[model samples]
Every structure is written in structure tokens, then in C-alpha cells.
Target: MNPYVIVSILVAYFGVLMVIAYFTSRNADTQTFFTANKKSPWYLVAFGMIGTSLSGVTFISVPGNVGNTQFAYFQFVLGNLVGYLVIATVLMPLYYRLNLVSIYTYLEQRFGFWSYKTGSFFFLLSRTIGAAFRLFLVAAVLQIGVFQQWGIPFSVNVLITIFLIWIYTFQGGIKTIVWTDTFQTFFLVSAVAISVYLISKELGLSLGQMVATVRESEYGQIFHWDPKSSKYFWKQFIAGAFIAIAMTGLDQDLMQKNLTCKNLQDAQKNMLSFCTVFVVVNLLFLTLGALLYLFAESRGIAIPGRTDYLYPTLALKSFGLLAAVFFLLGITASSYASADSALAALTTAFCIDFLNFDKRTEEDRKKIKFRVHVGFSVLLYLIILIFEALNDESVVTAVFTAAGYTYGPLLGLFAFGMLTRLPVRDRFVPLICVISPILCYIINKNSEAWLNGYRFGFEILILNGFLTFLGLLLLSKKRVAEPEVIPGE
Candidate 1:
């Protein structure tokens, strides 16, 4: 609970990451930064991805979300399982065969320049906002938990957090991130486990008893069949599958790490392993959420207005110093693990997709990349500030809604490229991508009146993609001969 102790822990944490970056980055070049020279171990990449996929949002929100949604989120988790399988069997092979550094390059080769840029821009827009929102959550937590007591401004906390990420990632990029994420995943999971154990102890329950309690609690209810509810099983499951494909298979931040594996087979293995572990980790978070509510009920404590605040408030005020220690460590690990990787992916995308980093001399390339990297860092800093000034919704909700809009176009573009052989009117590809999200926004806003009271959820991504797919079809021409099919079917 002491501010000095929290600062000390943070300093020590960044020191370890910096040391890791120093050694990994020795003699690193652009290839090493972007692809880790394609030598990352499958096992490490798999483990590390657990951190990147979850982030601070999942660390806090999923469990916190249990109070309102109950176990309904489990439906989405099941959907993610199917989505991962699709990525492993389909997308990974295509990416490896193409030998892509930035996955959007597939668009340029398959469609044309405009489609390629459109895809890359969607990624840039989606990831920039997603990563900034995540960093914002961490910065806000640190500002309240540690800095306010020391009379530091929120802006300073945001700057320091982003600066730490940049310091370690600026050198080795994916090479450093692949390893650091693995280390952070350990602390993040450990924090949840410890919090679970301490809460059980406070309630005087053994591990078995704790499990029993959570299983029987009202918050543990998982299945939902109501058509009107957003968390209904089929809706969540189907949406989760498409979300995984769109966000992970199609996302540069995640795929960048996947591409670092030695080969296609290794990448598939990593994805499968990551999928299995991801399910287990989420179960732990849900159980912790149920137990938190139970603990509060037994002690007669009032639940916070925002469920996101539940974990932090209890850890700092209700649990003792030890719980606070792990809470800080866990949140920092989760937030930085995702944010740092995203920063690297954003830099790689801009340099390759826009600036053509490969065309320049080695000396010139490095200078351009360094400046671009700094530029993205500044962009992320500004976005987080904007979010702080205006955000009123739960961050988890905001992130998925934003993804539905930004990542939707990417989902449509990739789906059209892979699933069809027709070539679109090249110049119109960007317009189609742009219009798809706007149409989606309008439809979503008026769903109740326009669609007979049908409320859209994350599945809005699927609808957006379909609209884009239809738009592409209108602009497309069938190949003269048998069309070239995507490699992995």
C-alpha cells in the first residue's frame, strides 16, 4: 500500500526488462526487430501470446464483468476456441507460404495497391486505438493507486508508462517482446492465483471449498439462451470465433509474434497451445470474480459503481499489503505485455506498409525507423490522453465496440481476398472498406427500429465483413481461367 514500495517494484520490473532487451538487441537489425530472424521458439511464443491476447482489460474486466454477465462470457471463450483452430489450420499456413513480415502485404499481392494500403490503415487505426485504450487503463490505475499520493499528475504517469515500453522495445522489437511477454505472463497469472488464494483464506475455505463456493455462487451462472440478451450462447460463441479470426489471425500485433516462429508448423503448434491455455486462464479469472463478490457479501461491503474498480479497491483496502503487491505486479505485467508488443507491431506496419523500409540503405533505414517508432509512441500518448478526457464506458466494452468498427473492414478485406478469386475494382477497394464501417455504425445505431428490435453485439463484426464482402463482389470480375485459390483452402 506504500507509494514508495510500489515505485520501487516498478523500477525493479523495468530494470529486468531493460536487461533482457540489452542482450537480445545486440547486433539486431531491421529483420531481427521485425521477425526475430524467424528463430523464436514455438513454446515461448505460445506462452508469451497468452499475455498479449489478454492484456490489462482481461486481467481486470473479465472477472469484473462476471457480476453483470455471470458465466455468459464462457460462451465467447468457447467461440475463441473455434476461431483459434481456424487460424492454425488456415491463416498460419498462408502467412508462412507467402513469407510475410506484415500480413497486409497479402492484400497488395492478391488485390492491388489501394487494397493493401486500406488493409494496413485499418490495422493501424484499430491497433493504435486498442493499444492506447489499454495503456490508458494502466496509466489511470497507476495514477490513482500510486502517483496521486505522491502529488504527481496523471499526464506524468502516462508518459512514464509509455516511455518504459519504448525503452525496451525500441531496440530488438519482436525479438525482445517475444521473451519479455513470457516473463510477464508468469507474474500476471501468479497474481490472479495469489489473489484467489488470499480471498479464499480470508473466507476460511480450503482450495476445494473455494472451488465449491464459486461454482455454487450466482455469479457463476454461465449459460444464456435468451435471444434478447447480448451474452446469449450462440451469439457469443459465433461472435467470439469471428473476433478471434479478425483480431488474432488478421491482426498485425498478434500475427507479428506468430510470424517469428521458425516455420508454419511451429506457428500452428503455438496457436493451438495458446488456445488451450487461454481457456484455462480465463476460467481462473471468472472464478476469482465470483469469489470477490462472495467475499464482499460475507463481509457486508458495498460493491463499487464500476465493476472495473472492484479488484483494485479490494486489493488495496481490504486485503493486506501482500495482496496489493501482487495486484500491482499483475496489472503492470498484463498492461505492459500487450502494450509493448502493440507498439512494436505498429512501428513495423508503418515502416513496411507505408514507408517501404526494405528499399532504403541499412543506415538510412535505421534512422527512418527510429523516427517512425518515436512518432507512433507520441501518437499513442496523445490518444490515451484523449481517452482519459472523454471515456465514460467500461474499457472492455469500448475496446470490442472499437474493434467492431475498425477491425471489421480488415475482416471483410481478408475474407474477400482468401475466399474469392475475383479481383475488385482496385481503386474502389479503399472506398468499400471505408464505407463498410460507416454503414455498420448507422445500422447498429438504428437496429431496434430498422431490424425489428434486433440489438447487435460483437457479432457486428460479422455483419460488417459481409457488407464489405458484398461490396467487393459488386466491384469484382471473375478470373478468365480457373482462379488462383488461397494456398491452405
Candidate 2:
């Protein structure tokens, strides 16, 4: 509960990260920063990615979501596994074959310059906000847990948080993250596992008793068979699958790490292994969630105003000092893992896709890359301030809502390009992509009135992608003389 103790933990954590940055970032260049010179081991990449994929959002939001949604999230977790398979089999092979630095470059090769820019722009927008959203949640928790007690402003907390991430990441980029994230993931998973143990102990349950207790608890319901609920099994399953593909396979922030591996087989192995770890990790979070609620009921504590507040509330207030230690470490590790990688990826996307990093002289390239990296850290800081001012709902929901719109166009663009051979009118590509999300938004906003009270859930992402696919279909021209696809050069 002491702010000084929390501050001590943070100082030590960043000290270790800076040391890693020092060693790994030495003599690193644009190639090293962007793809770690394609020298990262497959297993290390796999291990580190588990942290990036979970983020601070999962660290807090998923556990809290259990209060309202129950184990229904596990359905979405199941969908993520399906999505990971799609990425491994369908997407990674294409990225490897083309030797892409920015995955969006594939759009340029397939469609035209405008499509390429559109895809990159969407990634920049989606990841910028998504990363900020993740950071915002952690910043808020830290603010509550530490800074607010010390009279520090929320903006200062955000600035400091992003600043620390920028410090370690600005030099080494993905090269640094491949190792740093592995270190962070260890603490992240340990925090969750320990939190579960502590909470169960508070309730006087052993590991076996904890399992039986959660299985019988009201919060333990994992499946929602009701067709009308947003958490419906099939709906969440399908949405989760597509979200994994759109947000991961199609996302540069994630695939950039995968791209750092030595070859296609190594990358595929990373994806598969990461997928297995991801499923297990999320299951652990859900189990922790059930325990948090049961612990709350046992202690006669009121659930916090926001479900997002539930885990932190229990960890900081209900659980002992040791739980608080894990809470701070876990949240900090998870948040840094994702945010640091995002800062690197945004710089990579801008430099490669927008700034022509490949053509610039090495010296000029370094200058521009450094500036872009700083610019994004500032950009994220500003967005988190905005979100702090405006966000009222569960952040996890806000994240997915934003994703359904932003990532949907990406999904459609890639699907149309990969699945269909028809060439699009390259000039109209940007317009179609723009119109798809707007149309999806209007439909989603008015769905109940327009669609007879049928609500749109994460499945809305599927419709958003379908609309873009249809828009692209209308823009499709006659098949060109079989444009040469990448031959896995």
C-alpha cells in the first residue's frame, strides 16, 4: 500500500530492462531494430510473444470481466486458438515468402500504392489507440495504487510510463523486445499464478479445493448456450478466431516479432507454440477471475464500481502485501511488454511503409527512425491522456470495439487479396477501405432498430470485414495477366 514500495519495485524493474537494452542494442541498426537481423531464436520469440499478446488489458480486464461475463471469455479464448492456426498456416507463409518488413507492404505488392498506404494508416491508427488503451489501463491502476496518494497528476503518470518504455525500446526495437519480453513474461505469468494461490489461501482452499470451489462457484460458468447473449459460445468462438487473425496475423506489432525469426519453419513453430501458451495463460486468468469474485463474496467486500477495478481492489486492499507486490510487477511487466513492442512496431511501419527507409542513406535512416520513434511515444502519451478524459466503459470492451472497426478493413483487404485473384482498381482501394468501417459503424449503432433487435457483438468484426470484402468486390476489375505472386524468394 505504500507508494514508496511500489516506486522501489518500478525503479528496479526498469534498471534491469535498461541493462538488457544496453547489451542487445549495442551496434544495432535499422535492420536490427526492425527485425532483430532475423537472428532471434524461435523458442525465445515464442516465449516473449505470450507477454505481448496478453498485454495489460488481459492482466486486469479479463480477470475483472469474469464478474459480469463469467467463463464466457474462455469461448473467445478458444476462438483465438483458431485464429492463431489461421495465422500460422495462411498468413505467416505469405509474409515469409515475400520477405516483408512491414506486412502491409504485401498490399502494395498485391493492390497498389494507395492500398498499401491505407493498410499502413489503419495499423498506425489501430495500434496507436490500442496501445494507448492498454497503457491507459495500467497507468490508471498505478495512479490509484501509488501516484494519487502522492498527489501526482494522471498525465504525469502516463508520461512517465511511456517514457520508460521509450527509453529501453528506442534503440534496440524488436531486437530488444525479443529478449525483454521474455523476461517480462516470466513475471507476468508468475503474478497471475501467485495471485490465484494467495486468493485461494485466503479462502482456506488448497489447489484441489480451489478447483472444486471455482467449479461450483456462480462465477464459474464457462459456456453460454443462449443464442441471444453476446457471449454466446458460437458467436464469441467465431469472433475470437477472426480477431486473432485480424489483430495478430494481420497486425504488424505482433508479426514483427515473428518476422525476426530465422526462417518460415521457425516462425511457424513460434506461432504454434505461442498459441498453446496463450490458451493456457488465458485459462489461468479466467480461473483467477473466478477466485477474485469468490474471495470478494467470502470477505463481504463490495464489487468495485467498474469490473476492471475488481482485481486491483482485491489485490491491493483484500489480499496481503505479497499479493500487492505481484500485482504491481505483473501489471507493469504485461503493460511494458505490449507497449514497448507497439512503440517499436509503429516506428517500423512508418519508416518502412511511409518514409521509404529502404532508399534512405543509412545515416539519414537512423536519424528519421529515431525521430519517428520519439514521435510515437509522444503520440501515445497524448492518446492516453485523451482516453483518461473520455473512457467510461470497461477498457477491454473499448479495445475490441475499436478493433472491430479498425481491424475489419485490414481483414477484408487481406482476405480479398489472398482469397481472390481479381485485381482491384488500385486508385479506389483507399476509398473502399474508408467507407467500410463507417458503414459498419452506422449499422452497428442502429442495428437494434434496423435489424429487429439483433445486437452485434464481436461478431460485428466479421460483418465489418464482409462489408469491406463486398466493397472491394465491387471495385474488382478483370483478372490481370496472372500477376506474379511471391515465389518465396
Candidate 3:
């Protein structure tokens, strides 16, 4: 709990990452930065993705959220399982067949210039915000755990956070992330597993007793059937599927790692393996949540109003030195694992999709990539400061809510291109994408009042995508004679 100790842990953690970056990034060029030269081991990618997918939001918020939402989030997790299947079976094949460096290039090949740009633009928006939200969690915790004790302002804390990420990632990029993430995932998983054990030990409960206590507790319920409620089982399940598809399958940040695998089969194996581990890890977090609450109640600790604060407060103040240390390491690992990849993906997308990296000389490409990477890092720092100023609700909720609006167009664009042979008026694509989310916002705000008290949750993403799809359909003409085909396919 000492500020000096926290600083020591952080310095040591980043030191490990920098060492990994050094070895993995040596002799690294553009291909290595963008695709790890397509040589990453599938198993390592699968294992590392667990940390990237969960991030700090899951590390803290999911457990704390168990008090209010119970196991209801499991419905969303079930949907995520389905979504990952779609990504593996449907999207990954398409990406591999086309041999894309940036998946958004599919939009260009399938549609036109505007559609490709539109898709990439949405990705930039969605990932920038999503990554910022993830980093904000770690920044806030660092502020409370270390900087606040030193009277350091939150803005300065955020600057320090972003700088650390930029330093390790700027050179090796995705090549560095694949290795570092695997190392960090170990700490992240261990922290949660050990924290749960410590809590049970403190309460004088055996493993079986701990399981029984969580099951019988009021926070253990996992399904809601009310159609009008946001947490309805079907709504959450269906929304979870689409959220995974849109956020992971369509977004470059996640899919970039998948692309780094050698071939389609290897990528598929990575996804399926990641899906199985993803579910088990989430269940562990939920279990930890229930235990945190029970531990608090028995000890007469007042629960924090913002559930996000609950995990950090208890870990630092009451859970002993060991728990606090792992808590800090777990959050740092989860946050950086996701953020570093996001930075690489953003740079990759801009270079390939926007700047025509393929057409440029290698030397010119490197220079541009460096500037773009730095630009995004600074952009993320600003966004986190802004989020710190405005965020009021749970971060996990805010992340998905923002994704619902931002990623909706990507879902629609990909869905429209794959499912139909018709071409759209090229220039109008961006307009359709823009108009879709605005209409979705209006519909969501009035859903309960106008739609017979039907409240919207993550399903808003589905609606947003559908609206964009319909808007594109309205602008389409007669179908072409034949669909375009790749040479090998």
C-alpha cells in the first residue's frame, strides 16, 4: 500500500515489457510491426488475447458489477461465444482469402473508396474511444493507489500512463504486443485466481463452501426473462453475440492479432481456443465479485457508490499487501495488453487503409507509421482526460454503449457487402453511416415510451447496424452480373 512500493512494482513491470519488446522487436520492419511477419504461434496468440479481450474493465468492473447485476452478464458472455464462432467461420476466411493487411480493405474491394474509408474511419473512432476507456480505468486506479498519495494530479497520471504504453509499443508494435501480452496474461489471471482464494481463506470457507455461498447468494442469479427490462436473457444474449462480432470480428485491433497467425486454420484454432478460455476467465471474475461482496458484508465494509471503485478500495484497504500487489499488476497487465495492440492496429489501419502504405516506398512508410503511432498515443491521452472529466456510470457499460453506436456502421457495411451482390452509390456511403447512429440514438431514447415500455440495452448495436443496412439498400441499384472473386478462392 506504500506509494514507493507501488512505484517500484510499476517500474519493474514496465521494465519486463521493455525487455520483451527489445528481443521481439529486433530486426523488425513494417511487416513485423503490422503482422508479426505472419509467423506468431497460434497458441500464444490465443492465450494472450484473453488479457487483451478482458482488459481493466473486466478486471475491476465485472467483479464489482456482480453486486448489482449478478451473473446476468453471463448471458452476454454466451452471446460472445456465438459471436466468436461467426468471426472464425465467416469473417476470418474472407479476410484471409483476400490477404488483407487492414481488414477495412475488404470494404474497398467489395464496395468502393468511400465505403472503405467509412469503415476505417468508424474503426478509428470506435477503437480510439474504446482504448481510451480501458486506459482510463488503470489511470484512475493508479491515481488512487499511487499518485493521489503524492498529490499528483489525474492529468499528470494519465500522461505518465500513456507514455509508458507508447515507449514499449512504438518500435515493435504488434510483434512486441504478442509476446508481452502472453507474459501479462499470466499475471492478470493469477491475480484474480489468488484474490478469490485469499478472500475465501479470510472468510474461513473451503473451496466447496465458497462455491456454495456464491450460488445461494442473492447476487448469483444469471437469467432475466422480462422482455421490457434491459437485462432480459434474450436481449443480453443476442446483443452479446453482435457486440463480439462488431467489436472483435470487425474491429482491426482484435482481428489484427488473428491475422498475424500463419494461415486460416491456425487463426480459426486461435479463435476457438480463445473463446473457451474467455468464458472460464469471466466466470472466475464473477465468482470473485460475489466473494468481494460477501467479504465486505461480513467485515462491515461499506460498499463504494461507484461499483468500479469497490475492487480497488477493498484490495488496497483491507485485502492485505499480497492482494493489493496483484491487484495493481493485474490491472496494469490487462489495460496495457489491450491498449498496446490498439495503438498498433490504429497505426496499421491508417497506414494501409488511409495512407496507401502498400503503394509507398518502405522508408516513407516507416516514417509515416511512426508519426501516426505517436499521433494516436497523444489522441488517446487527451480522450482519457476527457473521459475522466465526464464518465459517471460503470466503464464496462460505457464501453459497450459507445461501441453500440460506433461499431454499428461497420457491422452493417460488412453485412450488406457479404449478403448481397448489389452495389451502392459510392459517395453516399459515408452519409448513410453517419445518419444511422443518430437515428439509433433517437429510437433508443424513446424506446420505452414509444415501443410499449421496451427498454434497449446492448441490442441498440443491432438496431444501429440494421438501420445502416436499410439505408444502403434504399440507395442500391440492380445487382451486378456476377460477384467478385479472389484468385485462389
Compare candidates 1 and 3 on lDDT and give the better one: 3
Q: What is the lDDT of candidate 1?
A: 0.90
Model 2 TM-score on a 0 to 1 scale: 0.98
Off-target runs (Cα >4 Å) in candidate 3 are 485-489
How far does residue 51 in candidate 3 sit from its true spot (Å)? Answer: 0.8
Residue lDDT tens for model 3, 135-238:
99999999999999999999999999999999999888898999999999999999999999999999999999999999999988999998888889999999
Q: After superposition, how far is residue 15 of candidate 3 from its true place, in Å?
A: 0.9
What lDDT does each candidate get?
0.90, 0.91, 0.93
lDDT of 2 by residue, 1-489 (tens): 888999999999999999999999999988899999999999999999989999999999999999889899999999999999989988898998888999999999888899999999999999999999999978988999999999999999999998899989988889999999999999999999999989888889999999998889888998998787788899999999999999999999999999999999999999998888898899899999999888888878998888888998779877889999999999999999999999999999999999888998989989999899999999999999999889898989999999999999999999988877788898898888888889988998898899777678898889989998999899799876255654332
- Give, for candidate 3, the lowest lDDT window spanning 10 residues: 480-489
Worst 10 residues of 2 by lDDT: 480-489
Please provide, for model 1 over 326-432, each residue's C-alpha lDDT reduced to its tens digit, 9 standing for 90 to 100. 99989999999999999999999999999978889988878988998999999999999999999877788889999999998899988888887788888999899
Clashes of each: 0, 0, 0
Candidate 2 colliding pairs: none
